[model samples]
Target: MGTKTPTEADILRPIKNTSTTYLALVAIAGLAFVLFLIGWSYQLAEGMIVTGLSDWGSGGGVTWGVYIGAFIWWVGIAHGGIILSAAVRLLGMDRYMPVARLAEMLTIAGLSAAGFYIVVHLGRPDRMVTSVVGHYHITVHASPLVWDVTVITAYFVLTATYLGLTLRYDVTRLRDQLPDRFEPIYKGLTIGYTEREDAIVQRMVWWLALAIIIMAPLLLHGGVIPWLFAVLPTYPTWYGGVQGPQFLTIALTSAISGVILLSFAFRRGYDWDHIITDDVFRGLLLWLGFFCLLFLWLQLQQNVTGLFKPPVDVGHAAEGRLGHPVYLTAMSLVFLVLSYIFAQAIRPALFTKKRAAVAALMVLTATLLEKILFVVEGFFHPTFDIYGATPGTYFPSWIEIASITGTVGMVSLFFLTVAKVVPVVELHAIEHLQGDDHE
Candidate 1:
């Protein structure tokens, strides 16, 4: 028999067939969710005392722990999804069409996890709900916290709508091939589908991509998030204009890393090596290398400038970061990985998907550590340093650790569930690219 061409049905196989591995993963995620609930409940019942955070006024201590660190990490990861999607859509990078929807979906999932962290960070979630809902204008306008919430909410809605709109075409195109059980979902997603709607979605998505590309870098990551840290002159390390670009760079790096891992999973799981392609990974890895360089350079800008003159507070903070073994080790590891990735870029023969994945993974770990250090150290050596308080010690409580675990589970669960309902790969993009190939 001639080589069988992969069809829509072939792409939909994951949704139709539930492998044992999938069930096991879902079950484990469910357990983590339960543990997360337990952790949050403990915080609610006991109080903030249960966490490693301490009141700053009484002297010194890390007010934010791993939870906030994880919060920043999750939000940063969310940035990549829409960015990758927007880039592909706006730039007409058809080579990446297969992974665009995956990137968008990852953005939605990452935002969900980030949002969940916000709720978990609140000792009393119900009060925050009432407070925000009841006094939206007063609170939202007045506080950076509220601004973060507002922008994140807006970004989530925009990304979700962007995903939903584009989804209409794919779901409608593959409707007949999908299992009957998914008919209702297909109906809901593709309500009022028409050939004209195709052009309409493309136009809308193009504008949406443009808007997100502008808003995400300027408003969300670079704008509000960095302001949250940079505005506090009390913290020498954080209080600077550099915060915006720094946060944006790390967010892109982590987000690209996330996309790499997700793409690898689907490509391997669904036998999509041809569609996903080595070229896709190669292109993404190059971008990853760029961000990695940017991340390191930004760190240099922040550190070298501070160390050049070395004011008391700046010198103190620098000593804390540079002198610490963990910080040194993480930075060294990131340098090594960045070097390897650059080498691969220079010598294409040196590049392999496995090495790219490994580099991405290391970057994720290194960045996560860097974020935690940034948060904890800023508080550890406050600009005021009022209480004669020394930089405080912090080890995440069990609750915090469990919550992080739960957030990871939540992201995975979100992707896995959505994959079953919709095609993980974009069908229309596939048709377009396949047609071009045939021609």
Candidate 2:
């Protein structure tokens, strides 16, 4: 890391003109806060009904409705960052070393947004303190919501800690240029700057990275997803054996694609076309293709097994999509097939053109649509809510939407603010080691 720290200007150079993206996102966050205010005001002035949540029958109702969805969505997005950065660190993937810093930062930003969104969802967002520290007299069952909060908080703290330590390693590179007075702060940052050797640094990196990977499945598929099973019956697309693992895979996939996209954009923006070459992204596209294929396979198996096996009756209508699984219907099938074709085959072909990029983009977009189908058709829709919703009829209001938007925006805000403060790229980590550090 010595003398190799990429400056703030270096990182920001690429996204400079694109401030508009962050701006719009920030505005949305502001609007969400206002919506939270309005929703709370309405609740206070007109009572709980104004904001939607009462005894809520026996179910968790609108309060946790979109909150659940939003939490999972953002968390899913954030998980990708962690796996790519921290997980890759442990896996000892040297190619990924460059973007580890950026990925870790992005993971923190996304998780922050998710946390804020959960905070806003609390109808009693104000009572979050009690929610965490407060006691529940009733015997508390293991709620997925509790797990989501707990994991997000722990991941956030852990990732932030690692990011801080790594960033210090980064700043150490610039030690010579800095004044003598700043040495102590730098020394403090590196925890006495003693863990600088490759042996010690690599060991520490291994621990953090391993902890994240082993716990990731629990935090997500275990924490956020089981609630769906508890709520939706065992037959739907969202609740079957595959959905949880599928979510984790897609998160990893999206994180991969997103990281690749950012790298390309960052390179183009910073004019680092030499260092950030197409080779970097070409490898990613191939890996992404593999992920796309696996996800498509998973989706096919879930839909086919559910569709062909049996159907449940929800009154007169076709209750579960098990009858046909219309959500992933024909369009989904076609896209999934094409995505796999392009991703698994064409994208990795030894041909050169814009084709790989185009194909990768297609696969990523289609995968996102796939995710929407997974969470929405079954989880968001009330018809699939015997175990989850009540008698069933869910229509989330403006507050939920705005609040969610704000939560996401706040995440973007976190990234923006943090980027402003810290070096986005890990210069030291990016150093091409001539010796064993190369690993």
Candidate 3:
């Protein structure tokens, strides 16, 4: 009767196959264990060197392959959460509350996934502190990744605090009536009566807008789009006028797209179609379409200039870190544009649920490919005698896999655990969503 809000029935209640959120949370805990085991095994059996990354002949050592891929993957995921929270809070949409918790939860999970193992991925794995603060000083102009890490850490703390506050609020609502075992927990969280309606509204707005402003550049910083250009044998692309911003665009596109996909998925899980409806998704798709066209134009402009450069003289372009013919021909340009059209355009206004899901999946797949090609494929530059040779292939060690699994699992668990106690969707918020759906 009360819109899936965690009622006494959640504990006193029995339902089919348990809550999806509960199962997901257990899965998360399992992943966390796997991650710990992986790290432990790596430390015991092979030692640090087995990580496959080393300060070899390359100028610096950083783990590529799965580590980098997962980092980007999780960052994209976190971006979705942050963007969603911003949307709801900034717009004052009540309907978004259900999935808003998930957004925040996923942000905590995905970011944690990336941050935890990056150190393991480091070549000089032990001196991580020295690298961040000492050797690799944070400079706004020099390297955005440094700032990226800093911003991400700060962002994570805020997300955690916000989510915790929300759960605590729910706990206080039920503490007296809750089982005696759980009563103290809620009491501990109250921290002297607070969380007035005005306070919640003001805080949410401030956090939503402020975070959006911070996140745009933060996404770019973590994206390392310019550095990927450095992977070009020539330094030109890295130094190019457009590459940095392009990377930022990619991050923004990927982030918002993720938000749409996740929103739809969660809605489907609960049969919220009456509330969420296709219209919300349609609006999101149109926005994605706009970004696609913008990105396509950028690619068209940059490539056209490259093609027109004189053949013999353009040899210097290689030295300037411009993309080689091989890299350029790779699928990013084609796939990036196509993914947008297929995912955002026809599918939204026309397709059935099944068809839309497939399209969403395609968007995710193509998006990952684009980021990977931009990161790994672009970063693959041979040195000295290895000149003109293709880049080496690398795989993620088990530790990395476990770490990622742990990240995903932990987040899933957090959602489930929270769902058992807190309200996952806003009953009041559902009215906001009704505008788009047919009753």
Top of the candidates by TM-score: 1
Cα lDDT tens digits for candidate 2, 1-439: 2223334345445334446755675576666666666765665566556546443435544334555566666667678778878655766676666567767877887687677656655656656667654643221355555555666778888887777767676666655544465566656766656544646665677788888887777656434654544355632444445666777767766677557755654565455544455555666666676766666677667656645534542221223343434344533643553464465455456434244445545545555444443444443344444554433335556766565556645655565555544456766544452233333
Question: What TM-score should be assigned to candidate 3?
Answer: 0.71
Error in Å for residue 125 of model 2: 1.5
Q: In model 2, what are the clashing residue pairs, if there are any?
A: 2-173, 3-173, 29-406, 231-387, 231-388
TM-score of each: 0.95, 0.73, 0.71
What is candidate 1's local distance difference test score?
Answer: 0.83
- Regarding lDDT, does 1 or 3 come out ahead? 1
Local distance difference test, each candidate: 0.83, 0.58, 0.54
Segments in model 3 whose C-alpha atoms lie over 4 Å from true places: 1-40, 43-51, 55-63, 91-98, 123-125, 130-145, 161-189, 195-197, 200-204, 218-241, 310-349, 382-410, 426-439
TM-score: model 1 vs. ground truth: 0.95
Q: What local lDDT does model 1 show for residue 317?
A: 81
Q: Is candidate 1 or candidate 3 better by TM-score?
A: 1
For model 1, name the residue pairs that clash.
Answer: 234-383
Where is model 2 more than 4 Å wrong at Cα? 1-65, 136-141, 175-191, 195-198, 222-224, 227-238, 311-396, 403-405, 433-439
